[model samples]
Each structure stands twice: as structure tokens, then as C-alpha cells.
Target chain A: EPEVTQTPSHQVTQMGQEVILRCVPISNHLYFYWYRQILGQKVEFLVSFYNNEISEKSEIFDDQFSVERPDGSNFTLKIRSTKLEDSAMYFCASSEAQLEAFFGQGTRLTVV
Target chain B: AQSVAQPEDQVNVAEGNPLTVKCTYSVSGNPYLFWYVQYPNRGLQFLLKYITGDNLVKGSYGFEAEFNKSQTSFHLKKPSALVSDSALYFCAVRDMQRGNKLVFGAGTILRVKS
Candidate 1:
């Protein structure tokens, strides 16, 4: 089965540095999303993208965070300045519509 | 605002026994509920979803959920559990009027012991 794929299974970045997480969603998917889960915490929604633009975002998705569909197949999330609290597992997901979404294995972001 | 509540933080069941993970939700409009499982060091895997039809929704891996509108609950159930079923389970909800973003519960750790 086709699945969302994320690169760099793990990443460690210095505080105040930038980091980019990449994801290739299923080819036919129309909606893409980014969510993060802090250790021992609930999965929190960050942002959703559709039609090459942000459809919606949560409070946690502040100015420091940005998402882009750099190409037809690549969706990337960039954090301009990483903070210690940014350490978490970042998941990329895509869906045909607003229905079931398939998730990627996740990129573990560690900011020291 | 939409929210999901997984009442139990953890549930323990023996292999071959039936298991149920409780989930209750609160939404403003018609709710779309989903159940996802996460194994250690893995992402959330879709298990089942309740959109419109039958209240009882069957999903992958022999898992099923019953959607109760009145009770505002969608509980995940599995008959004859296996050790492989042990993992972290999450219940999520999305209100049709609130857009497609899913609101997930804190998650429940299911331990199916052999």
C-alpha cells in the first residue's frame, strides 16, 4: 500500500538553528498535515495544507513554523529557529479528502 | 471545539479474551470519529473510522468500533485479543463544521498479555 514517507528518521539540531523536515505524501492525496508529539504527551496538530496553501493551523503553529509543497511530491516543514521545546516526533500525513489519513513513520526532532 | 477523551490511560487484557478501549467525544456538529494504533517507535496507524452509516464500524487488524451518538462515544473493540495487539491506542474526533483537523485524545496503552 502507498504510504506517506518522511526523510531523516532522526535529526538533532542546535538551539536557534534551522531544521527542515521533508515528506513525500501519497501521489494522489490532496490534503497534507503536520503533527507533533512531545515525549509522553498527546499528538498535537500543527498545520494542514491543501491546494499548495495552508488551510488551517493551530496556535502551536506560530510564525517560526512554515510548511511548503516545494513540488508535486514533496512537502516540507521548516522551523526557522529551533527551541528546546521543539524536540518531539514530527509526523506527516495525507488523505484523499477529509477522511482517513495515512501517516509517515515520523521524524524525530531533537533540539539541544 | 471538538475533543476526544480516552478515559483509561491503560488497559490490560489476557490473550484470547475480548478487549474494549473506552472513548468518548464532544463536538459541535456531526462528528467524524477515528481510532488509531501506534506501536513502539512508530507513527499512528489508522484502525477504523465512523463517518455516517452503521454505528458499528469494522476496521483493519480485526478491530471494530461502535459509534453511539446519544452517548457521544466510539469505543474500540476486539474479540480474542493477541499479544501482537498490545500498543498505544488513540481516539480522535473532527466536527464537520470545525474543518478537517482531527483532535486526538491523550491515548491509551493496551497491554494484551500472553
Candidate 2:
């Protein structure tokens, strides 16, 4: 079965530095999303992308956060300047038609 | 706003015994309910969902959930628990009238012991 794939199982970045997380969604899916889970916290939605543009975003998704489908298969999330609170497990997901999604193993991002 | 609530932080069940994880949701319109499981160092795996059909929805790994519209609850159930079933479970909901973003509960840890 096809599943979303995220690069860099874990990442440690310095505070105030830029960080980029990459994901390869299922080949046939059209919609993609990025979510984060702080340690011992609930999974929180960051942003959703469809048709090469952001369809919707949560309040947590601010100016510092941006998502781009750089190519047909690769979706990327960039944080201009990382903060300590940004440390969390970032998950990438893809859906066929905005229905249930297939998730990646997740990239654990730790900002010091 | 749409939201999900999982009252229990943890549920312990013996192997071969039945288990149920409670979930309740609030949405303006009809809700699409889903149950997901997460193992250690893994992503959320789809278990089951309630779209628009029968109230009883069966999902992967011998898991099932009953959607109660009146009570605004969609609780996951398993006939016989297994040690492999020990994991963190999340309940999520999407408001049909709203957008597609799913609001998830805080999650409940299921511990099936021998």
C-alpha cells in the first residue's frame, strides 16, 4: 500500500535558524496536509494544501510557517526562524479527496 | 467550531476481554467521525470511520465503532483485546458543513495486558 513518506526521521536545529521538512505524499493523492504533535500533547493541524495553494490553515500556522508543493510529489514545510516551542513530531498526510488520509511515520524536529 | 473529546486518559483491559474507548464530538452539521491508532515512534494509522451510513462502523484490525447522533458520541470497541492492541488511540471529526480539517481529541492510551 502507498503511504506518505517524510525525510529525516529526526532533526535538531538551533533556535532562530531556518528549517525545512520534506514529504512525499502518495502518488495519486491530490490534497496534502501538515500537522504537529508536541510531546505529550494532541496532534494539531498546521496547514492544508490543495491544487498548489493553501486551502486552509489553523491559527498556529503563522507567517513564520509556509508550505509548498515544490513538485508533483514533494511537499515541503519551512519555518523561517525556529523557536524552542517548535520542537515536535511533524506529520505529513495525503488524501484522495479530502477524506481519510494516509500518514507518514513523521519527522521529529527538535529546536534548541 | 468542531471539537472532539476523549474522556479517558488510559484504559486497561486483559487479553481476550472486550474493550471500549469513549469519544464524543461537537459539530454544527453532520460529522464524519474517525478512529486512528498510533504505535510508538509511528504515525497515526487509520482504523475506521463513520461517514453517512449505518451507525455501526467496522474498521481494520478487528476494531469497530458505533456512531450515536443523538448523544454526539462515536466510541471505538473491540470484541477481544490483544497485547498488540496496546497503543494510543485518537478520535477525530470533520464537520460536513464546515471545511475538511479534522479536529482530533486529546487521545486515549489503550493498554491490553496479558
Comparing only chain B with the true structure, the TM-scores of all models are 0.96, 0.96
TM-scores for chain A over all candidates: 0.98, 0.97
Model 1 misplaced regions, further than 4 Å? none
User: How close is every model to the real structure, measured as TM-score?
Assistant: 0.97, 0.96
Top-TM-score candidate index: 1
Best candidate according to lDDT: 1
lDDT of 1 by residue, A6-47 (tens): 999999999999999999999998988999999856999999
Model 1 lDDT at residue B39? 92
The window of 10 residues in a row where model 2 chain B has the poorest summed lDDT is: B94-103
Cα deviation at A32, candidate 1, in Å, is: 0.7
Clash pairs for candidate 2: none
Model 1 DockQ class: medium
Task: Report the lDDT tens digits of candidate 2 across residue range A32-91.
Answer: 889999884699999888888888898999999999987688999999899999999999
